[model samples]
Target: MNGCRWMLAVVLAALPVVAVAGCSSAPPPPPPESRAGRPDRGAMLIAQYGCGSCHTVPGIDRADGLVGPPLTRFGARSYIAGELPNNADNLQRWITDPQAVEPGTAMPKLGVSAIDAQDIAAYLYTLD
Candidate 1:
């Protein structure tokens, strides 16, 4: 009976330590927007927006139009439309309003919302 009581006490004492160790071993959670711009969602949005009608985007069905430059390996590019630097913010801006970035550019203003633009940019970045 004494041995059983000692074993129970040991087990109870170790519970909190084990719980703490488990928590400490886990990586911290990422920021809210860290994964908000998911590539899968972005791809769907691109197809829904008919972006494939102009740019040939990989992994999207019927994205073979030649009106605009092919988006293959777009993530490796250094610039957007050969104008603004290729980055998340710039890409979002260009997607939301192309004319604002370049007055005479052929790209039209699709009026994409900020979140959608972010998702699209995220998907584009995966092209690399």
Candidate 2:
């Protein structure tokens, strides 16, 4: 009876330490979602496509441009380049082929792939 009680007390004493160690050893939590529960993949795509050359995008490195309007709050905006609606589908379409959306628009067609466009749109929507 005494041996059992000793073992129980030892286990009880180690419970808090074991719990703390287990939690501390676990991997860190993932980064916060930027938009629509998706991770921030748009930032990389923005740089890869040289988007900063024409527009000033917030949170993107070296995304300062004076030719086009600043995209600081693009996510909150209602329209894309004053033409198409500012939804995911529209954004992807615009990014994939800008000239198709507006032939006369200054934004050229960068030939961005559909997947890259989607990721870019995902990143752009996080500007809010």
Could you estimate the TM-score for every candidate? 0.71, 0.68
lDDT per residue for candidate 2 within 1-128, as digits (tens), equals 99999999999999999999998997754332234424267788888889999899888889998888898877788788889767887888888888898888888888898888878877777777
lDDT for model 1, on a 0 to 1 scale?
Answer: 0.85
lDDT of each: 0.85, 0.80
* Residue 102, model 1: Cα distance from true site in angstroms: 1.0
Query: What range of 10 consecutive residues in model 1 has the weakest lDDT sum?
Result: 27-36
Candidate 1 deviation (Cα RMSD) = 13.7
lDDT score at residue 32, model 1, on the 0-100 scale:
20
lDDT tens digits, residue span 24-57, model 1 = 9977532222234888999999999999999999
**Superposed model 2: Cα runs more than 4 Å off:** 1-39
